[model samples]
Target: MQKRSVILAYILWLFLGQLGIHRFYTGRTGSGIIQLILGAAGWATTGILIGWFPLFVLWIWLVIDIFLIPGMCRNPE
Candidate 1:
């Protein structure tokens, strides 16, 4: 497998973390999918107003991932 880089991870986190692309890059595919679904659902449900909740959750998750990225890049479990 190609090695992961902290730089690339941060870049993806900055640009695509909303979809959990950074998590996928870090080999955390399971949680990545959760983020993916949450992001999609959050956006999709906006018309109903209930989407704010998921979007809020996703935002918090993204913020938390900012700190977790380095460890994920290093260990990648």
Candidate 2:
């Protein structure tokens, strides 16, 4: 059982978090897919002005993740 790295988790969370890449790295595949869809929709619809809602939700989730990353790195299950 390899341990996940807090630093790497944080890095992914910072760079690719909105798409839930960090979650995927921590083995949270279901949430990762949901976040991926939300992020994709946010980017794809931003131009037409329908994406802001999901983006806002994702932004809040990412903020919450700031503290969650450490636990995620530890468990990753």
Candidate 3:
């Protein structure tokens, strides 16, 4: 397997994580798509009164990802 760069992954996570870019970069396509959908939903509904909820969840998810990145960078068996 190819080596993954934690720095680059974190960079993606920092800049484009709302769109699930970091997850995609780390070879996690499924969760990436889910994040993407959630992000889009968050953005799409932001104008509504209840829209902030998805964004809030997304924030928590991203913060949790900060801890998961090292494990994500590990090579697959």
Candidate 4:
């Protein structure tokens, strides 16, 4: 059985998603950085209501990520 990163990622997504913490937890450093920047910029520039769209997308992305992280974590030998 493979060790899954999904649960951890989901938790981060649920809580620290605006900081892109979930992406970092999932080993997607580049995307994490991007999300962090976008999220921050959006919040700073537009406030929560306008910034929410990307956050919503991130939420959906996190949900989808739950199915993917486990597979990506599968050990190959």
Best model number under lDDT? 1
Q: Write the per-residue lDDT of candidate 1 for residues 1-77, one digit (tens) a residue.
A: 55689999999999998899999999999999999999999999999999999999999989998898888888877
Q: What is the lDDT of candidate 3?
A: 0.88
lDDT of 4 by residue, 15-63 (tens): 8877878667656688789878877776775654777776677667666
Give RMSD to native, each candidate.
1.2, 0.9, 1.4, 4.1
Superposed model 2: Cα runs more than 4 Å off: none
What C-alpha lDDT does candidate 4 achieve relative to the native structure? 0.68
Cα deviation in Å at residue 5, candidate 1? 0.7
Each candidate's lDDT (Cα)? 0.92, 0.91, 0.88, 0.68
lDDT by residue for model 2 (6-65), tens: 999899998999889999999889989999999999999999999999999999989998
Per-prediction TM-score to the true structure, in the order listed? 0.93, 0.94, 0.91, 0.61
Candidate 1: lDDT of 68? 87
- Runs of candidate 3 exceeding 4 Å displacement: none
Which candidate ranks first by TM-score, i.e. highest?
2
